[model samples]
Target: QISEATDAPEAFVAKILQPLSKKGILISNKGKQGGFTVDLDKIEHIKIIEIILATDGEEIFTRCAFGLEKCSSEKPCPFHFTYKPIREGLKSSLSEISIYDMALKTEQGEAFLKI
Candidate 1:
C-alpha cells in the first residue's frame, strides 16, 4: 500500500526489503496469500538506519558538500563543519528508531502528517 501510494519502483522496494529480509525483520510469503508483512517482534530490532541505507544509499546522509571522494575530519569540505551536526542528528534518529515504534505511533495518531 505504501509503495503503491508513493509510486516507488520494484527495485527500490526490493532494496528496502533486502537487508531486512536477511536480518529476518520482514518475512516474505510465497503462495496465493503471499505478500510482504512486518514481523512485529523483530521489527523493533531493526534500526531505521538500515532501511534508509538499503533504499536510498548511505550517501543521502553522509555525502561531502563538495563531492569529494574521501571527505572526513582531517580532509573536511568547505561546508563540513556546518553540515556535520545535521548529518549526525539525522543518522542518530534513524539508528534509534524501529518499524514497530513507527507503526504504533501511526496507529495511535501521535506522529506523522496524514497523506
Candidate 2:
C-alpha cells in the first residue's frame, strides 16, 4: 500500500524499507503473503531524524555549505548567517515530526507522497 500510494517502484520502496526496519521504525514479515507493518507506538515516536539517519546519514546537518577549510562561527562562510536559521528550522522540523503525523495525512488524503 505504501509503495503503491507513493507511486514508487516496489524495488525502490523495498530498499527504503531496509533502514526503517533496521532502526525499528517498522517491522516486516516474509513469505508468500507477508508484508511490512509498524507498531503504532513506534510510528508515533520515530522522528524524521531517525529515518534520515537510518537512510541518508547526518552529514547534511554537520557539513559546511561552502566546504571551506575553516567555516565555523569564528571564521564563518559568507552564507553561514543566512543558512544557519534555515538549517536550524529544518533540524527542528525533522525532529518535531513523526512518521505517524505523515501517515495520518496520507491516510486522510490530505497529502500524497506522490502526485
Candidate 3:
C-alpha cells in the first residue's frame, strides 16, 4: 500500500522501509496474513527530520549548495553564505512539521500528497 501510494518500486521501497521498521517508525508483521502498518499517533509525534535522517541520512543537513565536494565553513563555496540561512530555515521548518500535520493538510485538500 505504501509503495503503491509512492508509485515507487517495491525493491526500493523495501530498502527504505526496513530501516524505518528497525527504528520503530513502522511495524512489520511476519506471517501469511501479515504486513506493515503505521501507528498514526506515533507517527504524528515523529518529526520530519527523523524520517529524513533515517532515510536520507545527515547529508541533507550538510550538503553543499553548489554541490561542491569540498565546500565547508572554511573552504566555503560561492553560494555558501547565501545558502546557509535558507538551508537552516528549511531544517527548522521541517523539524516543526509532523506527519500528522502533513496528513491533515492533504486530507483537507490544502496540500498535495500524491504529487
Candidate 4:
C-alpha cells in the first residue's frame, strides 16, 4: 500500500524499509500476512533525521554539496560557506521534526507528502 501510494517499486520500498526496521524505527514481520508496522508509542519520538540516516546513510550529512571529492574548512568549495549554514539549519529542523508532527500537518492540509 505504501509503495503504491508513493509510486515506488515494491522491491525499492522493501530495501528502504529494511534499514529502518533494523534501526528499530520500524517493526517488520515475516509471514503470509506480514507487513511493516510502526510502534505508535515511539512514533512521536521518531525524528526525520533518523529515517534519513537509516535509509540514505551518513553521506547525506557529510557529502559535499558541490560534489567535490574533498571539501572541508581547510579547502572549501565555492558554495561551501554559503551552503553550510543552510545545510546545518536543515539538519537541525529535521532533527526536531517528528513523524507525528508531519502526520498532523498532513491531516490539517498544511503539508503533503506528494503533490
Candidate with maximal lDDT = 4
lDDT of 1: 0.77
Ranking by lDDT: 4, 2, 3, 1
Model with the higher lDDT, candidate 1 or 2 = 2
Question: Residue by residue across 1-115, what tens digits does model 3's lDDT show?
Answer: 7678778888888788788788888888879976777897687888888778788888877889878989988999889988988889989998999888887887799987578
Model 1, position 62, has a per-residue lDDT of: 79
Task: Estimate every model's Cα lDDT from 0 to 1.
Answer: 0.77, 0.83, 0.83, 0.90
TM-scores for candidates 1 onward, in order: 0.72, 0.84, 0.85, 0.92
Tell me the TM-score of model 2.
Answer: 0.84
Per-residue accuracy of model 4 over 13-94 as CA lDDT, tens digit each: 8999999999999999999999799999999999999999998877777678989989997899998888888888888999
- The collision pairs in model 2 are none
- Give one digit per residue, the lDDT tens place, for model 2 in 1-115: 8777778888998899888887778798899987788887677888988888888897677668887767877779999888778777888899999988988988899977887
Q: Clashes in model 1: which pairs?
A: none
Q: On residues 3-115, what C-alpha lDDT tens digit does candidate 1 reach at each position?
A: 67457776787667766666566778779976578766677777888777766778978788778878888989888899989988999998998877787788787975345
**TM-score between candidate 1 and the true structure:** 0.72
**TM match of model 3 to true structure:** 0.85
Model 2 bad stretches (over 4 Å)? 67-70
**Model 4 lDDT at residue 36:** 96
Stronger candidate by lDDT (1 vs 3): 3
Each candidate's number of clashing pairs is 0, 0, 0, 0
